[model samples]
Target: MNKKKLIVVENAIKEIAKRDGVTVEFVKMQMKIAMMNGVRSTDSKAKSFWDNISGKGKILTPEELIIHTSELVKQRKSQE
Candidate 1:
């Protein structure tokens, strides 16, 4: 992983475990599993996942990532 991503995941491990009352290793493991799921979704049957827009498996542009992140923010707000 890049340094920035490494830092993000490390901090995420801390934060998620603290919030969930789990061990850091368990949070890290679940995070790794989620990432693997994304990769597997990409590799199998050309499914759309974190890196893609649709099943044909085209990589998402930065704009798409921003739009998706914004949607996630709105969705989370609605849940509360």
Candidate 2:
């Protein structure tokens, strides 16, 4: 990840942790669990979407997911 994006994600996670009275590690674990469940769920659309970004047989780490999502959002905004 680029330095700016990394900083942004770190700051965001820190903010979430502060707001929720939890540690950053706790926030990261929850994110990982949520992503894992979403990818493993029976929803074909969700699976397909993640497969496109993450690859068919690969699971992304929470940091990778956040980076990919940030890139996607940046792409969409540029297109708009």
Candidate 3:
């Protein structure tokens, strides 16, 4: 994973854990669940990976968020 995304996820986990005063492991598990819930890309392999890791019955990651966002932006600009 990229540094920025790694930081985002790590910070998110920490922030949530701190707010609830939960353990780091609990935050990590919650993050895995959130990621699975958020996965929405079309790549089956990616989906599978996310699903397996998250235990959320999904296979996607927020890491792809920026990647797909830029792709859509490029596509729209091309059409315009």
Report the number of clashing residue pairs per model: 0, 0, 4
TM-scores of the models, in the order given: 0.41, 0.86, 0.40
Task: Assess each prediction's global lDDT (C-alpha) against the native.
Answer: 0.57, 0.88, 0.62
Residue-wise C-alpha lDDT for candidate 1, range 1-33, written one tens digit per residue: 245645654575588789999998886566556
Segments of candidate 1 deviating more than 4 angstroms: 1-9, 42-80
Predicted structure with the largest lDDT when compared to the true one: 2
Every model: Cα RMSD to truth: 7.7, 1.4, 7.6
Candidate 2 lDDT, tens digit per residue, 1-80? 67787788888899999999999999999998898888897999998888898898788877778899888999999999
Off by over 4 Å in 2: none
In candidate 1, list every pair of residues with a backbone clash.
none
Please give the range of 10 consecutive residues that has the lowest summed lDDT in model 2.
56-65
Model 3, backbone clash pairs (residues 3+ apart or across chains), number: 4
lDDT over C-alpha atoms for residue 22 of model 1: 96
